[model samples]
Target: MSLLSPKVPALNDPVLVNEWMAVATAADISKPTRVSVLGEDLVVWRSSTGVHAFRDLCIHRGTALSLGKVSDDQLVCPYHGWHFNGEGQCTLIPAQPNMPIPTKAKAFSYPCEEKYGLIWVSLGSPAHGVPEFMEADDQAFHTIICGPYIVNAEAPRVIENFLDVSHLMWVHEGFLGVPEHSVIPEYHVHEREGKLVTDTITVFQPDPDGRGKDVNNDYVYQVLRPLTVQFTKTDDQGSDVFAIMLHTTPLAHRKTMAYAVLTRNYGFELDDKQFSDFQDKIFSQDETILLSQRPEELPLDLAAELHIKSDRLAIAYRKWLRDLGVEVGVA
Candidate 1:
């Protein structure tokens, strides 16, 4: 099979196909924790000030530096007591007598930043800013931060699930999906500053069994390259709801870690506990299905497969990625 075929590529390729693989999560690597990415073992450490990342292997004997300890602002190797600073330069060598440390004795360092309640590392120079939570600053909205969940699927497939509203009816069934509705909502797809933005409006009427009254909901979905999806909802009553779903996949390509925040416009009489419960319920519904998918590599055949008009947004998203030079399987 071809390297870019259904078979997954090695994690150490010169160019990482996706940007989401670079995000650093607390659960993945806390202070003094070591993780591997792009074929290089790395250690992430915290000092009195902030966090730093460097190659985990010591330059002296190739021992894992993460197995060592943090001394003030420097990382001390456990094997030879060599000390390295936040800049990855070896600062001290206990055994060397009156000899200056060689300038070349430095560990490879990567640029990292903490944003949106997560740590992000850059494999290559990122020209764009980190993903932002659109509704985070709105005082009228109450926000809840749910923990991360590991899903066994490619990042693209997982993202497709969020962009695909059609699956809401079948995949979600009784939870939040509308199964009986046969009508497709009107949607608009446009590009904004190199990002794909989609707006869709769907109306729901009262069921004969007395489920709910007539309601119209508008959804806004934006795709920021590499790995970020923003979803905003507005109801007929002008009630606004916003959510940001961030997928940070590991370099291993076997799992994806996601962080989700759900918020609704404040001023409602609902208590904090009630609002928390509501957000949890909706996220739980998505978690259950995402965790069940196989961790297959991307490039799906959507054309040979069955599709409906409701899949318009999902199809557009795939095409957009392809236009950006992403490899996708053709029917």
Candidate 2:
């Protein structure tokens, strides 16, 4: 719940897909739950066989399968008592128990995998495998999954904002940056094989907790898809290496839910609550700024907005989305 009313983005165009997006946390889908993957309505659940994802609409009457319940190891539609198997095959219809289930009674099943406590779903056949974040599996690194922060902004805007380092000084002062060091130092941008990367950016910034002296660290932001961005930080700090991931589950054209996972080489002594609170604070700043952005959607036109040298990566990101023919929330 929020003090300000939330704005749900309107679904006006078809969503595109390339990356395997995290649709739900594994724990959240212990039972059946409705989710949207690249704008496709889905119902994800955990069964004895494993995790399964199906088009939420029932083959019979188009009722949302999510409104149904799990029964006898299968998803049962509430309206008609139709039971579906893990493979989305309608195995039993209480109204017609003696009749054999037809092949056409099956629902569409999508590709799904779980990693880092998240359920990753692909709207299309994925060419790339499920993504891995740094230090998530390392015993030495202390990691914490931070959020499902709901942001009332376009999915692409969330990615562009995460890739944008220049906003730190103005939008995240005192925590992520200070106005005194707002001048962005020269850095290179690289794009190849469907990934846009920043060339080792260094900025004088404060620790996210607003404690101790500031540390100047090098950053690497990787734009893996139209709506996924990640960054790594390294410096003479508590953590030998720090990594952050920003992934958005697009519920609609301009509405999204953001999730962040952080892996740190240090912070073994830090309490999870304290660490999570700090992360919440930092992300709240971004959420406030992003929701207020003009046009509400991300513009694919490079000329839509003025760009500084620091925004070279943002420009490259727009081009990537354009090349991929993404239209949802895109100009």
**Among all candidates shown, the one with the greatest TM-score:** 2
- lDDT of model 1, residue 94: 91
Model 1: per-residue Cα lDDT over 155-196, one tens digit each: 666677777766656554454446687466777778888778
lDDT of 2 by residue, 96-152 (tens): 999988767876777888787788887665777776565677877777777888778
lDDT of 2: 0.78
* The candidate that achieves the highest lDDT relative to the unseen native structure: 2
What TM value does model 1 have? 0.78
List ranges where model 2 is wrong by over 4 Å. Answer: 1-15, 209-213, 237-239
Give the TM-score of each candidate: 0.78, 0.89
- Deviating ranges (above 4 Å) for candidate 1: 1-9, 12-22, 26-30, 36-40, 137-142, 203-216, 267-295, 300-302, 327-331
Give the C-alpha miss distance for residue 108 in model 2, angstroms.
Answer: 2.0
